[model samples]
Target: MNRRHFLMGLAATMATARLSFASTGLIAPINIPLWKGPPPGGGGPEGRVIQSHSGALRNITVPGLSILLPSSPIGHGVLIAAGGGYKQIQDGKEALPAARWLIARGYTAYILHYRLPGEGWHDGNQVALQDAQRALRIIRQREKQVSVLGFSAGGHLLGMAATRPDYRAYTPQDAIDELPASADRTALIYPIITLEKPYTHTSTHRILVGPHATASEEAAWSVQHYVSSQTPPCFIVQAKDDPRSDPHNSLIMYDACQKHGVPVEMHRYPTGGHGFGMGKTGTETVEWPGEYKKWLQQSNAGG
Candidate 1:
């Protein structure tokens, strides 16, 4: 181990500790889904599971709880996706803090308990989009506005949902069918927007597509290509040195948004490795959420 690598590991560990503290009494328990049949054709399972699906047209319950902000029509609501690299939703560090962060800014926040791999409910990516689109529609029906935010694989999922020209995740009922074409804004914190070339998370790619999926199938899901002029205003934050998620992930998305003339703002911090949600540690990365908040205020997006 070299000096720099050792320090980087130490920094990551310290951030994790801060998360354990700042995140205390916040994250509710997650009810992990269990599968009964063969996993998805790839490396996933393929069978039925015993659990109440959030149902076809209602707010699906994941392992966590929702925290509603006290303000009325804060003008924005966010669907929060906690990252587990598409394997498990990290209820503690990722989901709860993110929800609370938005709530503090007077935005209604819904924590998504997306389907996990081998859970026998639905494909992880499909389940995540269904949850997000459902949340957007539910919030919009009541208030007519909302936004979407994600971190890591959750970030990737949101990117996929935002750029998709159609909704094929599930059957369309009035609620699901009537979903708006796009969110008002999207905040991607170290998102995995592209699986095509420069910065793919191989482990995550395998989990999402399974080992057997063709290269084309894997390529089809890459979020970078999904970006068009229709993409909503976006905010991105990244750690340039993050090993798990290459900084190029954010850079590629930024370039795509620019190419299409979509509004975008990105901040690339020199530190703060992967999974360092909400800048838990006293490291410089803690400033990202604050920076986003300022951008929101400037855009009149403040609550």
Candidate 2:
């Protein structure tokens, strides 16, 4: 089947499950916009998210859902985390297209709808990471290896998933903690790693930790300081001109990676403002995905 048709079928199958937002008296059907065009190379978009039995996940709003399977079934997979300065997923700029890009390169890709803001940052924090961990576990249960690729806040959550201990946001009946401890690799596109840094202190940090968070919590969230040899191989790309999230964010991450002797590839481009997911017009950051693809191949993730 063609890409569009396949997506429709997938949606149909998964949509049978309904999400009831009774606590807020809202019931919205999950609608994900599809990209119009030939299956963008290595994979077409066909992904869906079913409601979990877990009650009322906070701030979790999935604007869309889609997955890109590699041309050949390679056991490895990537979970695409769309960034939204802690507000909303920049769906167009970062979500589906990012998955498509990975699929084009021959890796199964899954898009996630974790929690959102106004639902409390702690809830958002816990829910997003739990969703990612669950997604990874679910995919792995099916025998597919999985990693996480996120932009901005999504990137932040991915970092949390990688570094933080696996703690369920809610109590569970199952004895086995299905969450995957480590993704084979983490691809961060201009991620906000260190809220302790001046550039990251004001905005993203506030959104994540709240207006009243103490210095200790911020230090805990700073992925750079949290990095150890245990952190996964990370590939980061940042734009030098991004005043919103400075290049130093990636620089600190790179430095930490080096300090821990973990493999890291950091590319700092001259220009490309923040939130340019999958890269964008007339900037070296536009070449980042291609460069990252090459890096993944060289690093042994492409096989």
Candidate 3:
């Protein structure tokens, strides 16, 4: 390894070394549904396990947040959305690990088990957004500053929330919906940013919009196009070799953020592939969680 590359790797390693995998003797997570009665959907036998072993959920009739409060909070909250390509919510591999990572760093974390769009929900494309918006609103009720992190398709959903602050997925069910759905800062880890041709995640795109989805429909869902000056600061991570979501997605998002003058930073690792979750052990991809910590501090996003 050359001097610069070695230094970069060493720096990333040192930065992430403080945050370990040890679950901080976690407090019982509060699993509260987004709605009291029924959600704005038509699906039953909810909470079906699609990946039987992964504990990824499907057809979520009762979408909700699994709240994890750190023993010592930094007075900010992170709402996490783990991607499952619109078919299942990958709680096992993504959300839970991420929540533990955040809470260990003294941040309250909420893992959103949002509904899948194709699971019989009316106006299905809007199902995930509604649940995500609701989860953000609920967190905002207790915390002053709340940020967000989305992985894979969850990144697409949270991307919508970050860009579309005024979109109403469903009629306001209560005052909880009054809170702003906007994020203080947004973090996307190997996210699926676009529904456009040749760039979209195949499973996510096929499930949310059919094979015959129109250009306008595709445009409407692309987060890069929605980035405005009003969009919050963004931090992005993607490995060039990512085979699933495509590293180009982050490039598109970074380009839009830059064009719009939104505060943005992107770290494109040469390797590490996709869905490394908290990152693959002993690899530079594991550096992101550390880099993210430094970003929260530098951006003062931990407020």
Candidate 4:
């Protein structure tokens, strides 16, 4: 059978063989605050509140991380950042499913509830990146290898972390800052990769760089410009028909990776639109998780 059919068959088999979280034999996740006390430069909207928008959490004041260990350990970890157009956190649609998928594959997964850029936070532009860096450092202490996975605006954050791991969003205030924040590999799904006009996600850019952003600031946040030989290997997924985020976002990043000789792979499906997650029952996008699994295996073998 062809690859698509094979993956569909596998999905059917897995569906029938799937086990519940209680029966999976995995340990429950431990939710940990990113900071020991109030986060640095913390002049955001007072008090942490859970406001919902379109059934997702928004207006986050306190950022944190949660660690879920796999039943069968592989000594690898993934930090997952859910996309919300930089306005909310899509934990239900993006983060949790991704974590469960990774855990079943024997890799520990950390789900990050990063601060939103427009949420009245001090230096809001940097808060999400700071939380991401802090989480990476913490995960590094336990896992020998750690990768980053992000969707939409979260993907933008992952790209920034991968390219500019040395850039500190906040001054060192503790021992965790001493650890490296770099990711070994990255996976971006329908990411917002650039701040440039036309291809850029306009609302995301406004929230991140502001409406009157300077040319220099725009260039600084445009992640593709920071790509170098040191940037981590990446696996990108997108759909040609995604109206929310242009497929060029993934294309430009892929081009830059190739230019810098950073190992990269990109899969673009014809349909599935934007934010389809692991794809529908019988679509081509369903093959992405399987492909990523193979890629990780190859990476482990030094391929």
- lDDT per model, in order? 0.63, 0.63, 0.79, 0.79
TM-score of each: 0.75, 0.74, 0.88, 0.88
Better of 2 and 4 by lDDT: 4
List candidate 3 stretches off by more than 4 Å.
1-25, 44-51, 299-303
lDDT of 3 by residue, 11-111 (tens): 34222221211233456676666775566654433332244355566645556677788888888899999888888877778888898888888888988
lDDT string for model 2 (16-90, tens) is 323322332223223332222211121222334333343212223232334545667566677778776665555
Q: What's the C-alpha lDDT at position 202 in model 2? A: 42
Clashes of 4: 0
> Each prediction's Cα RMSD?
11.3, 11.0, 11.6, 10.5
Give the 10-residue window scoring lowest on summed lDDT in candidate 2. 35-44
- Error of model 2, residue 56, in angstroms: 21
Off by over 4 Å in 1: 1-67, 71-73, 122-125, 198-201, 298-303
Span of ten consecutive residues with least summed lDDT in model 3: 13-22
lDDT of 3: 0.79
lDDT ranking, high to low: 3, 4, 1, 2
Clashes of 1: 10
